[model samples]
Target chain A: MTNVSAELDSRFRAAAAEEGLLDVAYDVVDSPLGELFVGISDRGLCVISYEADPDAQVERLARGFGSRVLRSTRPVDPARRQLDEYFEGKRKRFDLDVDLRLARDFGRTVLEELGRVPFGEVTTYGELAARAGKPRAARAVGTIMNRNPVPIVLPCHRVVGANGSLVGYAGGLERKHQLLRLEGALLA
Target chain B: MEPVRIPPFETFYEEHKDPVFAHLRRLLGQGAEDAFQETFLRALRAYPELRNGRHLRAWVFTIATRVAIDETRRRRPMASPWLHELAVEDGLPPHAELGHLTDNLPPKERAAVVLRYGFDLPYDEIAAALGSSEDAARQATSSGVRRLRERSKRS
Candidate 1:
């Protein structure tokens, strides 16, 4: 290896040594949008940032895990593997446990409501708020979505604007459109 | 640089997945998945233009690099020790002589060399990927190799 490569590898190894602290599990899942980053904990899938802003999301994740989050990539990441299967349409349901500790109360509540949004169908922002027992909080639902720690797993994209228009997806509206289309939820 | 046609999303993933992931992993250092996801998302949003397939790799790299650099600016974690070690090894004489001199450059230069040498891209492509001019990309890669040669001679 060249001197620069050697030095880079050394730093990488040093970071890898801290792997013991990062028990966070990860995987790459196939999505209608393409390959995606899916991370899980014992509770459920914790992080589901799209491919582009993965590190930004990782930094956000570190706040939840504290210093235990390490920097590394593993193809064998269970979450990624399962997600791959999921997007390939081979796996209809995910069995991975996720860490929900990072979710705030409203966020958790919104996510739970989102989970009820059966696959192959879609819901509205207001409808989701009503399901969450916050009928007046339709816009708050949008805020909850902006803060959603997990997207596809929680199915946040399944929720649309009150007017039934596709709007405000954190993962990008086109992805939201595509995911909805893939699940056969996009209305003509 | 050639114009790149954005293939059907599914087709794009199947054909370019490995190289794209490899690029993202290398560019972002860590958190490659997020960069990878973001890259496709951006592509999804701006699909019609990424035609021609000629500069497709460079285009993808450009997005990944921007996303990674943005993340780095936001979250500046120390490089992993392994990364440091790899950088050091790349500076050694044996590596330089092998023309494997590509490995240990600074992260940005390393990225440029990898895209240029490993992928056989032209300087324009590398510059586009890096959001710099061809001259800048050339300078970065040249300087990076020059430094490697200097370090190799000393070692």
Candidate 2:
């Protein structure tokens, strides 16, 4: 992005927003853990990240989406609003549109199964892999969960260890436990 | 003529955003972003019909300058003081701050000066962008420059 006047950049953003030409528009929203960058494609919310480095994401999105990505708040507004509600314990299920184009094949299959885990429900990685028709591929399920493009909305945090221990989360185990606790999956 | 092959909008955006944005910022004062948006919006709308790839840069600049000038007319019937305070603290380029430079001149002269010196547009291209004769564009730029010099000296 060149150093255009802030006003012009905003105007450009507004028009892109109006036309829905922003291939991947994103904005940062605050959560109890930290700031999260929420991105959306025209179809639905696409990517969420713990890191908000614009330059790196811009390059990454350009390569992935084949268009310019901008920091448009409007497209991701619903995602932000819903995430806010979920984090606040006011909402249990997310009804936002999701673009899962970034997920492929087994990863896509694994995520779809994970999305069905429901709020306040817990499933083991092996259970998730079995639902995706690859019971022995529990490790693969874990890998897919780690790279889940849209995390909380997909409910990867609901996937616990096969032994029912809190194992791993892309956002860290503490966040995973917190999310489960918020959902009443954990007594504490 | 067969339509010139324009890259996808995302590719175009990645490739040209900086130059186009920098150009609009230099041409317009405060709300250059709006102009940048409008310019690209119009360009994208007409991109399919653009016949010559070689003229893309100049073409984008043409739309940018016009959008910028049009924005000047649409918003800000009266200049605000916030831009004034920002300009006074100008540690960088004097004209780069914009509010003072934009307020001091009429819209046409401002466009001419911004295109000429700010963007280094030749008189012919500036005239094309301004929808006037080259000679008139040259005169407008000259007068706009003289006013800026006098204002700076007084300040």
Q: Pick the candidate with the highest lDDT.
A: 2
Give every collision pair in model 2.
Answer: A7-B33, A8-B32, A8-B33, A8-B34, A9-B33, A12-B37, A67-B10, A68-B10
What are the per-residue Cα lDDT tens digits for candidate 1 across B52-150? Answer: 656566666766665655565455434322234334545432332232344356767876655554345678767867767899999887777677667
lDDT of 1 at A102: 66
- Give the whole-model CA lDDT for all candidates, comma-separated: 0.61, 0.74
**Candidate 2 C-alpha lDDT tens digits along B41-150:** 88766765655565566677667876765565456534532334333433223443454565569877887876665456678778766667899998997787677667
Among incorrect, acceptable, medium and high, the docking class of model 1 is incorrect
Model 2 Cα lDDT, one tens digit per residue, A102-182: 789999989888888989999999999999999999998889999898888999989989778988999888889888999
